[model samples]
Target: MRYSAGHKLETRERLLQSSALSAKRSGFSTVGVDGLMKAIGLSGAAFYSHFSSKDALFSAIVERELGQSLERLSGQGNEDRERLERCLKQYLSMAHVEQPESGCALPTLGAEIARSDVQVREQAEIWICRLQESWAQILQSESLAWAILSQCVGALVVARMLATPDVQRTVLKSSHEEIARQLAVQRAE
Candidate 1:
């Protein structure tokens, strides 16, 4: 049975979404194309119909996950300190840590992306820079913007790594407070 163009596109989207969730929950390299297609009720052969190769699929996932983050971090026309603070909170929250499949892909996939093909790394890098520049526009400090990006990703990574909920909260709260304080000091200067 043949499918319509629209049906094929929808199937591709479903595959991407399922792949993203699986990649975040499990490591990207560990989830085989065969398993992913089976999870979505499609045969492994159909995977090639949508993606030329698993590497291509990984590139697509990087694009999708980071693209969603870049869109969110871009914010409205107004790039104010308040908006930055809100972004920080959202990024640092326990909810984000607990739901790897639904949250930012940086901390989860950064190492893998670093080791991926140049195209995949570039996909992640371009979006990451966009996010940093967005924050820099508001902060009026490029160095601080880079620091903010690093700190958020680092804190979340640590928070997710620790097994204790209390430690996770402590990590989140401490980093959040320190970052807020830094911003306050920068504003006062």
Candidate 2:
């Protein structure tokens, strides 16, 4: 059987999107190549045609997820304090806490990324630093940017760890409040 010219690219994209969501919802290391491919309706052997290896797919997922995050968080060339605040509110929300697969990858995948090879870690670092750079410009302090970034991701992770919704909401609220306070202080300075 023959396929269209775009068939390969479309199949690859499907694999990437499906695999990324799976990795975010469950740990990347927990899923093998066969599992990843199976999620997208392909056999395990077909995985190599799209990606050289599982690690390659991981790198691609990191790049795609972080790139989307950077776009949503940073906006385009005109991010300001208000925009950054809105981004934070969304990032630290209960919806984000409950929906790991559809949201940012950091909270879910940070540990796995840290344990990945140098190349994968480097891919993540590039996007992470760019995100920080965007926030730093608006916040006017590199340290503050890092702090808020850490706080946001940490808050999500902590919120997800709790069994009760009330405690989870408290964790999100506290982080949001503290981050707002810190931003207010920075603005005053």
Candidate 3:
């Protein structure tokens, strides 16, 4: 049976969304086209109909995931100092550590993106700059914005790497406290 245009579009979005989360859970390199298609209950042949190649899917997922991150960072989440603090609290929390699939893509897929094709890397760069710009709006310094972002992403990456929850929590706590102190100093000056 032939699917309508809207149905095809909906299927494509489902594939993209599922693949994005799967890639977050397992690096893009580790997820095969067949497995990805199977996860969405589509035959492998249908994948090529929607995407030229696996790399194309990876690129699309990077764009979609990072765009979401940009929205979270730039949107009302960072509206005021209180909101920003609340956002950061949740950002570095244990819950975020436990659920990388539904969380930010940077810490989960940054390394994979670094090794991906130019198109994928470019998508990564674009969203990163968008997020940086958003943070710069609040911090008023591009350098500080990058530093804060780096610390938060690094904290998450390390938290995911270690075997123990205690160490992970410590990483998150230390980074949170350090970032807060740095922000306070920035405000004073």
Per residue, candidate 2 scores C-alpha lDDT tens digits across 1-189 of 876769999999999899889998888989998888888888999899888989999999999999999989984556478898998999999989888999999999999999999999999999999999988888889999999999999999999999999999999999999999999888888
Q: Write the per-residue lDDT of candidate 1 for residues 1-189, one digit (tens) a residue.
A: 999999999999999999999999988999788999998999999999999999999999999999998887765666467777898899999999999998899999998999999999888889999988888888988898999899999999999999999999999999999999889998999
TM-score of model 2 vs. true structure: 0.96
Backbone-clash count (model 3)? 0
Q: lDDT tens string, model 3, 16-82?
A: 9999989898887887888999999988989998999998888899999998887776646435566
lDDT values of the candidates?
Answer: 0.91, 0.92, 0.88
Model 1 lowest lDDT segment of ten = 72-81
lDDT of 1: 0.91
Measured against the true structure, the TM-scores of the candidates, in listed sequence, are 0.96, 0.96, 0.96
Name the Cα RMSD for model 3. Answer: 1.4
**List of clashing residue pairs for candidate 1:** none
Once superposed on the true structure, which residue ranges of model 1 sit more than 4 Å away at CA?
Answer: none
